[model samples]
Target: MIALEKQLKDELKRFEAKEESIETIFIGGGTPSTVDPILYQKIFKLLKPYIKTNAEITTEANPNSATKAWLQGMYDLGVNRVSFGVQSFDQDKLKALNRAHSPKQAKIAVLTAKEIGFKNLSLDLIYNYQGDTKALLKSDIEQAFELPINHISAYELTIESGTKFASTPKVRQEDDELAFFVAKEITKHGFKHYEISNFGSYESEHNKGYWKLKDYIGVGAGAVGFLKDTRYYPSTDIDAYIKNPLKIKEESLTTDELLTERLFLGLRSNIGVDKNILNKAMKKRADFLVEKEKLFKDNNLYKNTNYFISDELVLYILG
Candidate 1:
């Protein structure tokens, strides 16, 4: 924890961030609720000057570990938002996904946060597992809406390398329709489908910042930071990072790479691509899609009509 504080302090120094410049801060990428909130105090104290007064500060928590005391401590520290990893409300599905918490525990964790005065709460739901069905996903969505949360992120099950499912890849179902089903069910309840995987009555500022290609400072092991066209990375190994927090890597993105990123990110969300950023060939392809009703041009920006076909459309434009 001390090492992380030092590293964050160093990273901020390098960036020369101005006071009240950070509009949002998200503490995620791992199970953060397991850590004592006291450990977070120094980091918050150090970042207080740079964080805006109305900053949408968020921390990702596991339902099993985010106890009432933990939520209260973080709330006292000015963390006004919480994103819980609920995954699913079905016991069998939770077991299948190897989640540590039960449905009851997930409910308690979220309700506890709400009772503690958190106005902004979000939870994640995973769909398209081997046994996932419309009935099952519908129930999951229904249970989620029962909670006092404004946001939900429904993700399709994908086998990533190094995970147990990578060996038995069949655990992930290959169902395209379920994505639409889940999206429709979520938006039916009034939350906007602001991104491919996320829906919310109150949209996430952190998510929007990334899609709009805004620069952000990332800290801790394996965290990535962006400044203009360059990306910064510290050591991935926790021990190595703590030992020498200064060791870092840098990558400068090419113009073509940046363009590809913009196309994918912009199409995946309501943050449509700027027309001026497209070359003549890409513009021609985009216009063709607009003619086909696959995309709609909002004056100077071109937005996707269906996020599900976003990848294919971006690839078409790129070609």
Candidate 2:
């Protein structure tokens, strides 16, 4: 761990020297909580000079791995935000997903994080489990709200092509109705539906940058980063990352692609996109959606209805 920390610090120094600015830093993937707190402190110290003071420093942790002492250490070291992988509150569903923590641990972690003076807490919830009923999803959202967290991220259970779930015969996907129900319940609880996959308090500076397509630096195996018009990603192999941290695959966006991506990401936010950017076809459809009560024009910006289904809204606007 000590050696890895040194390598990471060295990489950050090199990157900072080359890059002009950084808006956010996200420490995620492969159990960052498992790393020693001292290492975290060192990494933060090295990053202090390069990162903006208000820059959102975020780290992901599994509930089982986030010990109380570690949480405090992280707080003292300037980690203002912590996101836990609390997939579900149902023990059976947790087991089915091969999660390491129990439902109780999820609650405990939230309380503990709050006790440790970390106010910016985010919980991850997965909906559309193979057997998830609307009742179960509602219970999950209710449980999430019970936590003292200000942010909640709910994702649909997508069957990726290479995962174990894909190879094995599994039950059918949870119907769209259940997924929409979960999203609606979350908004009713006062959390802002900032993005399609993320919900939080109105002050989510870190994630807001990502949603707005701002610059961020991600450091870790298989981590991807977007800075200005360029995108880069590290190799997925751990050994490869440690050996040659500078070996990153890079891509530059074309002018047309950049404008399209900006519109795509901007439409996901509550702030909505600039009305002037809507093409002729999109303008006609947007008008129809407003009439259907699926979307509304507010201050010249088209915004989705708070109770409207997210996927339907997206399809209507973009598809």
Candidate 3:
């Protein structure tokens, strides 16, 4: 935490805060609750002036570790949002997924955060894993809505290389119908389907900003930072990063590469791709999809009606 704080102190300077206040700060991907909240205090204190007053401060937590005291400690630090990694409510499924927390613990963690005055609460629910059925997912969603959470991220299971599941990739069931079923089930509860995998009454600015290609600081090992068309990779080696935090590898994207990226990210979320950003050939292809009802045009923006085919749509447009 100390090394991270020192690195962040320098990294955050890259953003010209005079032009715009930081809108969102996301502490995610890892188990944030494992560390003491007291460790985060200095970082928050440092960020106060550069961040907007209404900035959505979110921290991702594991339900098994986020106790009431931990939740309270984070709440006291101006952390207004908690996104628990509660993959499912089904005990059998939880065990199958190798989750640490039980359904009871997940519920308790969320309630504890709410009790600590967290207004924006979210949890992740995974689908399309082997043995997932409509009934099982329905029960999971029902259990989730019973909590005081305002948001849910429903992610499809994908077999990334090098994980245990990678050897048996079939564990990630390729069921398109189940994907549609999950979306319908979640949105029927009155939440907006803002992204391919996210549904919520209160949308996450941190998430939207990423899709819109906004610049964000990335301080931790292997974390990525974006500024305009270039990406910065801090040393993934933790010891090297702490020893010399200034050393970073940079990659600058070409116009085509940047456009390709924008299309993929935009089409996967509520942020539609701007027609002006597309070249003449790309614009014509997008217009053709719009006419074919595969995509819908809202004024100057071309949006994918079905997010499942976002990759195909982008590839076609790029061609």
- TM-score of each predicted structure versus truth: 0.98, 0.86, 0.96
Q: What is the full ranking by TM-score, best candidate first?
A: 1, 3, 2
Predicted structure 1: lDDT: 0.93
Q: Which wins on TM-score, candidate 1 or candidate 3?
A: 1
User: How much does each candidate deviate from the true structure in C-alpha RMSD?
Assistant: 1.0, 3.3, 1.5
**10 residues in a row with least lDDT, candidate 2:** 13-22
Stretches of candidate 1 off by over 4 Å are none
Q: What is candidate 2's TM-score against the reference?
A: 0.86
Q: Is candidate 1 or candidate 2 better by TM-score?
A: 1
Worst 10 residues of 3 by lDDT: 11-20
Which parts of model 2 have CA positions greater than 4 angstroms off?
1-23, 169-174, 278-294, 298-300, 306-319
Candidate number with greatest lDDT: 1
Runs in model 3 lying further than 4 Å from the true structure: none
